[model samples]
Target: MKQLVILAGGKGTRLKDRLGDLPKPMIPIAGKPLLQHQIELAGAHGFGEVLLFVHHRADLIQEHFGQGSRFALPIRYITEKEPLGTAGAVLAGFDQLADRFVVMYGDTMMNVDLTRLWSAHEQSGADATLFLHPNNHPLDSDLVETNAEGWVTTFHNRPHAAGQFFRNLVNAGLYVIEKCALEPWSHDRKLMDFGKDLFPALLNRNAKLFGYNSPEFIKDIGTPDRYDWVCAQYEAGIVQRSSLATPQRVVFLDRDGTLVKEVSAQGLHRIEDLELLPGVSAAVHELNQTGLRAVMITNQPVVAKGFCTEEELQQIHNKLETLLGREHAFLDRIYYCPHHPEKGFPGERPELKIECKCRKPEPGMVLEAQRDLNIDLANSWFIGDTTTDVQTARNAGVKSILVRTGHGGADRKHDVAPDFVFESLPEAVQFIAARSTETSGE
Candidate 1:
């Protein structure tokens, strides 16, 4: 059986503020964490045995997935007390790895066909196979120049060299390695990355390191904005959510105005005022029964405005859940931006207003939600009552629907028009259900 090793030890320092208290791999995309998706993908690719290398938050990972049997694959964990570079982590798990194994970065997500990658490696008869993808911004990444036969000729770490080779290809952070490749790395060496160190050493020894080029979706969620983008792609169906046993889709809704009446501009000070629009609960229930996750993305500037505290917002959301529960409907997840643009208000500050990608119209919330939830945006849809919501979907490259309830009806007269418009939430549900039926040939 093919063995898979995932490097899951990164602290994700770049995303510390946004994903506090969680390891980089545990950061959520839509509703599920990134690590969950990686595991699911391994299972999907038919890997019977898998290994996870953990250092930071090792307990969190172990607690959540003890054996990985639930995912139909056997998983083992190796914890490191000190920092181990990419190659080191793989070497650390050397005993567990099979003669032929696949190694990948845990914090990054990709839709690569492992079967094809493995086939290529076997056909080339190479000691190692490196996955490569076209790079538009080579300067930001380590550039790899390859020969006509797909053998990597030179590896440049952030080189300023200007040429066709620079724009040709870059490492996609996925690799298949034979057990012999690890023999050369000195056991005493520390702080080594595969691209910068191991691959170069292999090249000097004239080892067979072949490159496999395929059409695969790859993204590095090293920063908050990238995290958001990956999530949105999943929601829009641009990329498949790796968590589900079978293909699953979701419709992300903007809460404040799309499902319920817009919180009064003066503010929703009371729980009783939280009211759902006509047919809103029923529409959401329909989606839930159909195996779709109905997530809420709202911008509650109230906390930043000092109209209420974060606690107040949580209480209001609690009230919303109670109200919806009465109708047998539930929200899978709720994401809101509490920061505001100006600091005139006592609790608010100009820094909060400084341009942020997560705010509505920026696609940050939708993207992050997609990463956590694994929603497919191209196959999924976003329904809201405001232009910002529509713009958010557009910026994130997802389909947008506008419901007549709340601010939606008013938005029709604005400059941008939604892909579809409905007089009420039920109408939108009916339309989507019919479309789904048509798609499934039922």
Candidate 2:
């Protein structure tokens, strides 16, 4: 079991009304302090020691969990003379840290399965593994980009450029880091943050950084609005159900002609050509409120035909994500198969022209999603615009919906019939939402 370090020094400027005499982490949630919940969660996951980095009103925090006996873990505290930034505080206490440790923020409310995150870090041999996820308000958030192998490629800090495109992956304020990775910067530390400063600086040195993408619920209660929202969600049992220990209900979606317009048969290879059909964003936003995971599973064979490069394909999907995000909607994950079984195009890449299992109508993509997301396929559903997607659902043993938008079963590539038919994605999503409500007896 590794040690856990919590940055419990937030002053709660925006939450002043809620924190009159108490520190931010000492604020009560369900009759107990928020920091206690975090420690209990860490202990449940086998963390034997806790290192609390405190500054604001350190007395209250010290008096509450002195020695961590009641919690069955040893609690250690390091009070800072001056406020250091998130990473600076950790670097300031460098000698007290373990060889490897987990970092968390005091303000954010999370129920992450830390064991799963730890296993990923140990297997990759990377200097650090960041917890990345897509959030609705990504324009103002710090973002990270990753390659297909889930390796961090670059960091996009806050105050993002006006029109530059970026993936919707946000740094969800949780991380796993190696002490040796910080040794290089231990002596020259000033005010620094993990996402904005330290992480980017390490990337320049060619240190391997991994991005662990997850869809679990983790929100920062920084503002009064956000604080109240999290309290309500916690009362509704949403927080408890979001842990990765439980299986999630997913609504798997097809990309072309389902969410984005089917601009051409070759697929919308160019970024400018990608556009959302009517009511797509709002429908997805509504599904988001239902707590069901929205995962994009699409077959993109344009790369095999050399009609578009993988870089161009990423931009097109970024456009899709940006459009949905503008309306307060986002997907949990986007999985695409770049292989095409058929060959002989004018500029086709012969390597990508081989038969593969990930192509749709095969269950490879869906099964892979099930394993990564812990999806309950028996209660899951898939919606698309072709009989090929219908056959994919049948092959994966999940309910299917066909929308009469692009191809609309007119391709007739397969003689499979969808379990349900609709004129558009909105209608199909409405049916699923209503069915879920009926099943849950809500």
Query: Where does candidate 1 stray beyond 4 Å?
Result: 162-165, 241-442
Per-residue lDDT of model 1, residues 1-442, tens digit only: 9888899999999999977888888998778888888788778788988888999989998988889878888889889768879987787666777889998898887776677678889999999899886432445567676664778888878755442223235688999999877876645347778998889988999998998753256778998888887877677554553233334466878886677777677556565677777778788777754546677888777777777766667767755654565476766667788776665666564545555777787888988876655567788788887877787778887888987677754654346768998777788877887786577444
Question: In each prediction, how many residue pairs overlap at the backbone (N, C-alpha, C within less than 3 A)?
Answer: 29, 0
Best by lDDT: 2
What candidate 2 gets wrong by more than 4 Å, as runs, is: 438-442
Best by TM-score, which number?
A: 2
Q: Give the TM-score of candidate 2.
A: 0.96
TM-score versus the correct structure, for each prediction: 0.55, 0.96
Instruction: Give me the displacement of residue 47 in model 2, in angstroms.
Output: 0.4
- Provide the overall lDDT of each model, using Cα atoms, as 2-decimal numbers: 0.75, 0.90
Q: When superposed on Cα atoms, how far off is each prediction in RMSD? A: 17.6, 1.5
